[model samples]
Target chain A: MINKTINQKAWFMVLPVLALVAFNAIIPLMTVVNYSVQETFGDNLFFWEGLKWFEEVMRSERFHDALGRQLLFTLLILLIEVPLGVGIALTMPRQGIGVTICLVLMALPLLIPWNVVGAMWNIFALPDIGLLGKMLNGVGFDYNFTQNTFWAWATVVAMDVWHWTSLVVLLCYAGLRSIPDAYYQASKIDGATSWQVFRYIQLPKMKRVLTIALLLRLMDSFMIYTEPFVLTGGGPGNSTTFLSIDLVKVALGQFDLGPAAAMSIIYFLVVLLLCWVLYTLMMRNETN
Target chain B: MSSITLKSLRHSYLQNPQSEEDYALRKIDLTWRDGGAFALLGPSGCGKTTLLNLISGLLKPSEGQILFDDSDVTSLPPDQRNIAQVFQFPVVYDTMTVYDNLAFPLRNRKLPEAELDERVQRVAKMLSMQNQLKHRASGLTAADKQKISLGRGLVRSDVNVMMFDEPLTVIDPHLKWELRSQLMRLHQQVGFTMIYVTHDQTEALTFADEVVVMYEGQIVQIGTPEELFLKPRHTFVGHFIGSPGMNILPCDWNDGGAVFAGHQISLNGNLSNPASTSKLQLGIRPEFIRLASEGIPARIQRVDDVGRYRIIKAEVGGTSLNIYANEEVEIPSDSLHLDFDPDHTHVYCDGWIHEAKGQS
Candidate 1:
């Protein structure tokens, strides 16, 4: 073994990155922590609340309803988008000019700004003038979304699928493209049906990308606010109000900052915990 | 098992091919008997793999038909062709166990579970993979993965032809020789028609009974290993099949003999009505030329000692020539000469060997 010199100044190189992260994430997070444990009025006067807000937010029936609605929305979109995305990607052409055309078409929806997507669908699903709404009502169904809770939920879900399914399609397409041609040739020579080829060859190869698509859609659909807020404004009663929309109604709309801050922290923790659990589950299967 | 035949087969990747250069595989008409081990030997971009794919029905020929023992199969898909192809890379199913990977082809045909298990077990045993049958295929080594791919073909009972497209390319060098011999042994035991495509001369010459040498999308020659060495039908075969290749010398046809560097050299056969307009050259393997006391005079330029023999590079009238001499042979310092073995030397018109009269 050779004698090696250790430098004490090497740690200085990491200071800038730490400082940048502290300002961007850690400092803002600490303000939320500060608000969660205390109460404040318009004058910035504070009083120790001692976990009272956490208790209130945890026990609130409104919070439970919002959480349930968020979970259901995430589950619904994930069920619809992931399979639909994978199906579209599977049917896309694998080569030639058609590949370029299909890829560009898939990427079109993802290129729109999130708020623009929300605003565009808000008008696009209008009952009287919009093509989709007029056609639905014209086909002999009473499909007005402004006052109906079911139609409101349906419109929001459809808008989210239309705006976000393209992302999953592109991700799964990249994964599908990475597979070697030999696998397909071998499967063909093995006399596998199309379903068997998908089950044995395509699915296993797309697992990594599908995991990414799931996590992204799960988190995005959970924190969904812009599209549904613009489309239904949490509906005529509160049926469409998800966790973020509920938290916003409390924090900004109703000015209940203490409970709202606590709710925000809880929401962040839920997303983090859910993503961690899902990533661990997926990676565990991969290693085995 | 069936004898394969290709009748005027041609293929082009372009939708509208106007010239011969547009064809990836030029017109080919050939046949192979059942249970014959043949190798398509060529350098890269020589359409060996294209020919293999056309035979296996992965690609349909742009023109003409492919026959498996006199039945046209040009329009059939690869699955319906009843063929198996091991690719250049290992194509095992990663999520499957070794046993499942082998059983896949048989199970797809809905063979009874009892027969499927028996066939899988037989193939696993033959590949020496019986102990790893329960192991996941992705967890195995590269060579083991390749063996699993090969085992997949072996488990199928109805496969008429087993094609290999340079299956040893991804294998380690030490494992390559072992896998090659195992393939030869497997071919002998099963006695199926095997067509191996490769660019490596040693692999092709050793694995195949009759090596089909190809160049620029055309089959140059098809002959046994000894025949290729002794009598290469094309100049490309003479250059491609041997180590350090055969030596070619530009010559002129003078009085029915090849005149090379002011020396009249006799050929293996009699020349009849040679084309005066076509270019002519003399071809001889380095092994067939030796240092002589009385022949075409040459000056020794350099000597490469290849352990067993020394390749003597000499200059004759401004042209370079290579001769092989044994390690113990003495080299004359002054006035060195070289002699060509008439039985092995041949004259070529253009790129092809001239089919002179009185030859076998």
Candidate 2:
């Protein structure tokens, strides 16, 4: 049996982090819960309206549209990012100074702040001064992202792919590096074609990291707010108004705190539900 | 099964090798018989693995030809070579069931489902892995995982050769012996041309019918285990093939005998045209060094108990020689006399030994 010691000193080491987390997260969470089930007209006059805001949020068509848009965006991200990231990682060098250079370059976009990514892409996609827009216009093509709904949606998706595909690449690259060289040698001797090698060895070996990349990208894209907001400002008549933007418009812009708080809770639950389903599925697959 | 012939094979890692000095493997000429179990035995960095990689087609020799059954396949890739390799570490699909991992290669070829199942079951049963067929490979222990890797390689009988590169290095000690014996049985049942590479003497001696000892980027000797043990062609082979290794003492050749540290020992035969300038040494295995009453005087330094035998490390005329005796024998505390068996002793010049013309 292991000797058990209860010094309580390690708890002191974590006290500062606990205090910061309480201030940043727990207190605001309590306030949201308080506003979720109560009605406040003014001067903190609270009246009980149990389940009323939840019922309103459940029936809201705007909430449904936003949720649909979030799900579609996340699905598209997964469909594109996972395969493209693995492909790029496979083609990368296994060693030498080139590996270090490629790793550093792949990690640059992930290190940039989210809002800065938004602002940078905003300037770069403008129809007149933007490089891509001007180049397309120079070739006699109609490419105004801010005016057309289809173009706006395409621009947002493409921007997201450019911004976050590097994250998947870095993760997959780490996974690829962790595989022993012996596996490749074994595959070579197994008379495996290049496609067979990728399908059987590389892909199966990358399952764990791919799952993590999938979940992270799913959550991040579902909660996406900055890039599309900065690029089109949810213009072209709600074509790109994702759930986060719609939630913000309701809660802070329109000051419907009770219903917004209820919507926020519902949104949190949706994300949590999806995450739990994915986790359980992956864990079950692993166990079997 | 098919024979492999390597002709003037040379390999170099550098694009432009400076002169003939930068080659990792230099001008190797070897031919392996059909269904022969050959071992490339060498210390680390001795180009044994490089030669195996060339045979497996993972590497193309920089200068020469690799032929399988008289067909030139020097330019072929590994997939085109039709070979199976078990690596130093276990390589199995961790997410797949152990049975599925064994069945993967057969299924890849689109073999009939029944035959694939039969082959997987047969190989798993041979490896004693049938009981764990339904377990996910990730949850199994390392030895079981290695068995799965070996089974994956052995499941396909149509492959021309099966190459193993230090496949048992990671297994537990007791399990290593069991795995090596199982490998021998597998070889006997399925006569695939096998080339196993390892640095361990016991693994090489027990598993291979023909052991090719390599040193300094070249094969020094290729013979059976008994031949290598009885007559090692090179000093490195003599030093590498035995347990405590062959005891070597520097000697000066005189008339019909050599003087080793002021003690003149008569040789078995006369040397004709002996090396005039190079340094010479006398080599003998510990088992051949006889401990008796009338020979060169020696003092016992240390005794090591090796279960069934005891190793007597003693000094005779300022030269250290080890003698292997039965564990039940007792050493006298006073002076001791030692004599080497004339037929078993070897005379070395430079690094190669001068073999007697008519010796077996």
> Highest DockQ: which candidate?
1
The pairs that clash in candidate 2 are none
Residue-wise C-alpha lDDT for candidate 1, range A1-288, written one tens digit per residue: 999999989999999999999999999999889989999888989888979999999999999999999999999999999999999999989988999999888888888887888788878878899888888999998998888988988888898899999999999999999999999999999998999889989999999999999999998998999888888889868999999999999999998888999999999999999999999999999999
List the DockQ of the predictions in order. Answer: 0.79, 0.49
| lDDT agreement with native, every candidate | 0.90, 0.86
Among the numbered candidates, top lDDT falls to 1
Q: What is residue A239's positional error in candidate 1, in angstroms?
A: 1.7
True contacts kept of 1: 0.89
DockQ of candidate 2, scored on C-alphas against the true complex (2 decimals): 0.49
Could you list the chain B TM-scores for each candidate? 0.97, 0.93
How well is each residue in B264-339 modelled by candidate 2, as lDDT tens digits?
8767766654677988899999999887888888899988889999999998777888889887766877568888
Writing each residue's lDDT as its tens digit, candidate 1 over B1-360 gives: 788999999999999999999999888999999999999999999999999999988888899899999789999999988898999989989899988999998888999999899888889889998899999998998899989888888898878899999999989999999999998999999999999999999998898999999899899898999999988888899888777788888998888788999999977666774699988878999899878888999998888888998888888888887888898899887569888999889888897888776665
**Candidate 2 vs. true structure, TM-score:** 0.91
Tell me the deviation in Å of residue B207 in model 1.
1.0
Give the alpha carbon lDDT tens digit for every residue of A63-143 in model 2: 888888878888887888888998899988998999999989888888888888878877777789999888878899788
Total backbone collisions, model 1? 0
